[model samples]
Every structure is written in C-alpha cells, then in structure tokens.
Target chain A: MEKRFLAIGWVLSVLLLMGSLSGCGNIEPWVKPYERDRLADPIMALDGDPVSTSYLQHVYEAREGARGGEGAAGGGCGCN
Target chain B: MAAKARPVAAAAATSGRGLTMMLRYGLGLLALLMAFSTARASVLPEDRADVLYHLYTGGGVDIDGPSILVRKQVGKSVSVVGNYYVDMVSSASIDVITTASPYTEERTQWSLGMDYLRGNTTLRVGYTSSEESDYDADTYNFSVSQDMFGGLTTLTLSYALGDDLVRKADDPTFQRDLDKQNYGIGLTQILTKNLIATLNFETGTDEGYLNNPYRSVRYFNPSDTSGRGYSFEGELYPNTRTSNAVGVRARYFLPYRAAIEGEYRFFTDTWDIDSHTASITYIHPWRDYTFTGKFRYHDQTGAHFYSDLFPSAQATNFRGRDKELSELTSYTFRLKASYAFLNESQSWGFLKKGSVTASVDWLFVDYHEFSDLTANALIGEEPLYSLDAAVFQLFFSFWY
Candidate 1:
C-alpha cells in the first residue's frame, strides 16, 4: 500500500510539474495585467479564501469525518 | 612616543570613517528585517469584503444540525471571522461495547479568527469554545505561513491548545479534566500552474481522564469453580495518548474546464490503532457557476484491550468490566457534491460580491468486535451495517 501510494504521488507530481511549467508558456498571451479585481470574484480565490459557502460546507463535513471540499480533509474521526 | 602618536593619529582617522560605514550598514540591516516582517503581511484590497453563512440538517447513523460563519476584512492586513454550530446526533457505533445506548448528544460550538498578511507571509490566530450537553471545551490556535521559492512553495506551522471539562451524572466525584495540544507543519508546492501538491504532518497529545464514567464492562461468571460470576467496577483514570498523522494531496487539472484531486492520509496513535483514508474529487466549471463531486473511504483498527466483556476471575489486576475500550474497529464511506454561484457585480444595495453554495453528503459506517466478551455483551440492537446518514447544507456569503 505504501508503494502504491508513492507511485501515485510520483506520477501526479510529474504531471502537475509539467503542466505548471507549460502553462507558464502562455503567461504572456492571456496576461491581462488587471482583470476586474479577481479577488472580488470568488472563483479566483477558490483555494485560499475560506469565507465561501462551499468552503464552510466542506470544512464542517470533513471535521465530522464525512465527505467535504473537493476531497480535502479526508481522514478518520479522532473521537471515534 | 612620537612614533606611537603618529600611528594613533592615523588609526583615529580610519576609525572615524569606519564608524560611519558600520553605522550605515547597521541601519540597512535593520531596515531589511523590518521589510521582511512586513512582507509577511500582505495587504488586502480596500474595496473587497466577504461574508458567509451555512445551515446543515440530517440524520442516520450520524446526525447533522446547523452551523453559521461570517467574516469581513476591515483593513488592508486584518480580517475577522466568527463561527457558530449546533448538532444533535444519535449514534449507534461499532465501538468497544456494541450494546450501549444510541448516544443522543447535543453540541454547540463558537469560534473567532483573525488573519494578517504582509509581504510574503501570513499569520493567523483563532479561539474556539464548545459545549456538548455534559462536556465543555475551549481551544486556541495560531499559525504562520511564508511563501518560498518565489510563490511555488509555501511552508506553514500551526499550534493549538485545548481544554475539556466533562461532567457525568454517574460519578458524582467524576471530573473529566483533559488537556489537548497539537502541532502541525506543512508544505504546499505549486508543481505546475494546474497542479498543486501539499504534504502535512500533525502531532496531537491528550492528557488526563480518558474514560467514560457511564460506560462499563460487564464480567460474566465462568463455568469453573473460580468465583468468576461477580462483576467488577472498572474505571480508567489519567491516561495520556499521542497521535501522529501524515497526509499528501494533489490536484490535477483536466481538459475542458475540469480538474481532479486525490488525497491520502496515514494515521497512528499510542493506543496501537492505525488507519488510512483515501479520497478523490472532480470539479467542473461553467460560465458563472461551479460544481464539485467527491468520494472518500476510510478504515481503522481498534485499540488494544478493547472489549465489551472480560473474565471475572482473572489472576491479574484486571478491571473486571464488560467493555474493553481498545478492541473495536470500523470503516466509513462518504460521498458529497456541492454547487456554487458567483456574483459578477454589485447585487444588493451594499457591496454584495459574495458566493452562495449548497451541498449534500451521504455516509455509511460498519462496526466490528474482537472477543467473546464483545460477542455476548449486550450491544446496540441495530445491525452493524444499519448506520447511514444524509446531510444537507446551504451557505451564502457576501462582502462589502
């Protein structure tokens, strides 16, 4: 199981690294120095800002050992 | 004396020049440190605000209730958050004593959080208090994070302290005083623009009374002549436990406005129990709305010496109890989906630039037992597989 997890991690890391590097290739093309205050838009801060409705729903569920935020906080209940 | 005076005169001249240079260098170093500290706290834009509220309702093997949270950024570097939650649950768990009452517990929780960002670092502090019918608790948490490797990597360290006071009706003298502490360190690396990976490790420790005063193990008389029929008063006191967990999660962007994330966690505790959790999620984005779906699986082994019954005439100094705490195991499966709506421009009279989200979750759990003590012990009448729960939640957030 450990080996399997490792293999999966390695593959995902490589894939993501490649994607991020390649994505930088287009930075100049779509680069709008300013785009209507992305922070004002919820989608841009989807990962960090916890004040969103979905974030709360997921946090509560994850703390309860239930499914939550896009597969985040997947773990056992310490109290259980 | 003349030669010495000549060298001293020359040295004095050099000393004057060197003193100024050293003074300037010192001032520059001080300025850099100040800049570094400030850099940790990045300023938030003045025109942005966010608020959110959530409500949850559900029942099954697990019960869900309602919760609310609201946050606002009032300054360039400061945001305040408040949260409250209430839950009423009836749990028929597959724990050590399969036969205990379906715990109908009531819980209330409240918390406040503050965050400051400057330069390339963020600092956060929060305090939380909770009451669950017979139990009361208070917790404090602080964390600091710094962006590394030019924003590709982030490192964070967090610490938390908790105090619990549990009052039980069974033992008038029973005061379950507990102290819990946790320390976590994590790193998040943006491997690629579309892929983010994070690794985190946490250590938690609990000290003081760790047993349930109302729960007891019933000992049965063995057929042998060894007077084993008498039940023993079992109680545990002042037990300390520590737990450590490591987890890794990654996000992979897919084609056509979609992304997939996968996560794995491994956990173990001083009670000799080990567990693992795995989960996957997929996100789909549309013009003004977004949807997400996720599935999770978790498995755990029970602690050592956990049982529902024991031999009454054991030769050792045994707590002749029907329930042994360390011998039960369980597994759970959960599925959830959520949808969110983003506001493009000001909607309400005030700045209403927030998002609304709603989600549903389902969970199933199965319990297991270890020994005959557990087999014969009166457990919950419900089948092990009868535990299931469905949760629904709606949340709305806006900023000024």
Candidate 2:
C-alpha cells in the first residue's frame, strides 16, 4: 500500500509541475482598480481571518461530537 | 508567458478640440500615468512563507505530517501562494479491530493561488487539489473582500466547487463519489476602536453515494444476532448540512508595547450539533521583535440517535446496527512563539527585517461507549480510552 501511494504521488506531482510551467508564460497580471475594490467588499470572507482558528475548533467539535449535520459533512462520521 | 502581456491603451483625443477639452485630456493622461507608476513601484516580497503541523494522541489518534506554504508577489496587484500538506493516522482509538494494531491512512494536498489588491478592495482566486490513499478531491475557489468606513467594516464573498471519490477497503462493488459545491458570505464590523464582531454563513451540497463499508451499528433484538450479529451494512445518509456562525473579538493595547486579544465563536449545524469555542492571546514586544502566547477551550454534545446497547434478536424491531448512535466529547490546547530580525536595511546597525517563528502544540482526545458492542466478536468490549499527540511548526517571512 505504501509503495502504491508513493507511485501515485510521484505521477501526480510530475503532472502538476508540468501544468504549472505551461501556464507561466500566459499568466498575465490582471489588475482593475474598480473591480479590485469590488472584490474586497467584506461580504465574503474565506474563514474570517482574525477569528478563524477558534471558529474552526468549534466546528470540528460539532461534527465529531455534540453537533450533527447542521454544517458540512465529515469524511467519515457525521456525529455531532 | 505570452498570456502575461496587458498593454495600456491610448485614449482617443480630438485634433481640433476646444481649450477645455484639451485641458481635460491632459489631466486624464496624467492620471493614467500616475496609476501605472504606482503599479510599477509596488512589488511583492520574495521571502514570505509559512509552515504548520499538528498531532493528536489518545483514544482518537491523529498524526499530521509537515506542511509548508510559500507566497511571492509577482506584480503590483498580484501575488502567488503555494502549499503542500500530508497526514497519516492510526485507527486503534476507536476499538474496532481485534488486535492492538493500527490501520494506516495518508493524504496529500496542494494548491496555487493569486491575490489582487486595488484601493480598499482585495480579490483572490485559487485552485487546490488533494488525494488520499483511496480518496480524491479537487477544488476551484474564488473570493472578494472590501474594506469600508476607513477600514472599520469588512465584507467578503466566496464560492467553491469540488469532486470527491471514496473507495472501500474490501468491496469492489461499493464505490462512492460525489459532486460538491460550497458558498460562503461573511461580514466584519468594528464596533469600536478595540472591539470587532463578525457573522458568517456557509452551505454545501453533495450528491452521490455516502456509506462507510468498515463502520457498523448494533442490533436491538437478541434473536437478530444470529451469531453473525448486530452490525448494519451499506447504508447511506442523504441529508444536507448547513452552518451559520457569529463571533466577536477584542484587542486591548497595554503599556510597554504589549497587547491582549480575546475571541469567541458560536456555531450550529443541521445535524443538531451546536458548539462554542473561546481563546485568548498575549503579545509583548522586545528590543526588535515580539512574542505571543495562545490558549483555547472547546466543548460539544451527541446527536439524538446515539445508543449504548442493542436489544435481543427475538425483538421485532431488531435493526442489528451499532454505530448510527454513540456519544462523543473532546478538548484541546496549544502554545506557540515567533521571533523576527532585521536581515537587510537601508540605515544603521539594526537587524534588517526578516522573521522566523517556531511553535509546538499538544492535544488529547477522550471517548466513551455505553454498549456491549465494545465486547463484540471483532473487538472485545472495552472501556473508554484517551488519545494524545503533539506537533511542531516552523516558518519564516521577510520584506525587501
């Protein structure tokens, strides 16, 4: 199983490296002042920077123990 | 790199324009030049990077491998970030296997992302892909954030689409795959100079097979044991889980360049799980650097269907399941520190501004069961157990 996993990882790494290199030449710096401001609007935070660590800890406990499916599903058990 | 070219286009100007029109054109040209010059002057630093690692020992064993991340600014409004992570886990904490042995699980994840800044707004887009020993996942995500009221208020929107595939250990015919989509919206308000509050909502939808081939539940009827006994097989959960959270944090600056921050989170999911977490950090500045310490606490409860025992096989409602119901609870603690130095500077003997940080964290897990399922055929009924683990992380970031 370990050998198989290593083989798969090596193949995928090669593929990803090739793909990234191919895009290097075409990767343009897209900068639009108005659009950039629109993007920064606070309504969509990825994980809420300042308080994210504690929040993630809370969610992890919910999915593993006290909470059920009120949030996203877990990899195995959905117990809360 | 042919796709990297974006030339500034010249504006159309009338050859025989009025003096006012000519003056307006001249001012527009000057504004355009200023914007270009600002872009040229802003450069992304080459030395910014981060690393994180974690481990959990005791009843619920988890050992996360070393993970690394690096970020580089490519242009005025563009920066690129890359990351890689690996983790290996053991299954002895759950008490399912007969031996005191452990099953091995591994996962690898990587991603590349771009962040763009314009005035008071920032836009970020990225693609990440991950592969487990037997599962695969790929995600494409994008988000936009803006600062309002002179940085007092912030808002963001994000979306992601992903694909998941799960393969069972022994069953060739039992394969599960799902298409998943997630969306999030958040808002942060600065109630005062020292207080901040944030509210966020996230929703996800998944469609396809959802069943664990190696998991089971006990039977209610004694007759249903049939010696082959109480574990349910091949059942899938079809409900969607939605979550909403509200949080508040405050920071107070003290004398001698010291500050304290406290934060709390209230979260709930559709599966009936509600949780609360709180943490505090203290930062103190020394001669040329700062040191920080953190502490946190968390708690959670069990779902409605959790059960500790199964009935006799003769009972009519004999479901022969063991897992759909088990109570769970846990706690965690962490400590970390960082130091910075001046590696390169324009002036005197002060260290030239480069920083390196290293930290260590320890965690523990305790689990209990209420049923005879513990002493079942595959695994002898055993009491609760505790899992313990520790992790180390190191990182460096610099500005030129």
Q: Each predicted complex: what DockQ?
A: 0.05, 0.03
**Residues B348-400, model 2: lDDT tens digits:** 34323466656555554444553433444443354544445554555554443
lDDT of 2 at A16: 64
Off by over 4 Å in 1: A1-80, B1-62, B90-105, B170-172, B222-238, B313-342, B370-386
Task: Calculate model 2's interface RMSD in Å.
Answer: 19.0
* C-alpha lDDT of candidate 1 relative to the true structure: 0.49
Q: What is the C-alpha lDDT of each candidate?
A: 0.49, 0.45
**Model 2 chain B poorest 10 in a row by lDDT:** B1-10
Model 2 spans > 4 angstroms off: A1-80, B1-47, B52-56, B60-62, B95-101, B191-197, B220-236, B287-290, B310-327, B341-353, B366-386, B398-400
TM-score of 2: 0.64
Best model per DockQ: 1
**TM-score of each model, in listed order:** 0.67, 0.64
- Give the lDDT of residue A23 in candidate 1: 41
Docking class of 2: incorrect
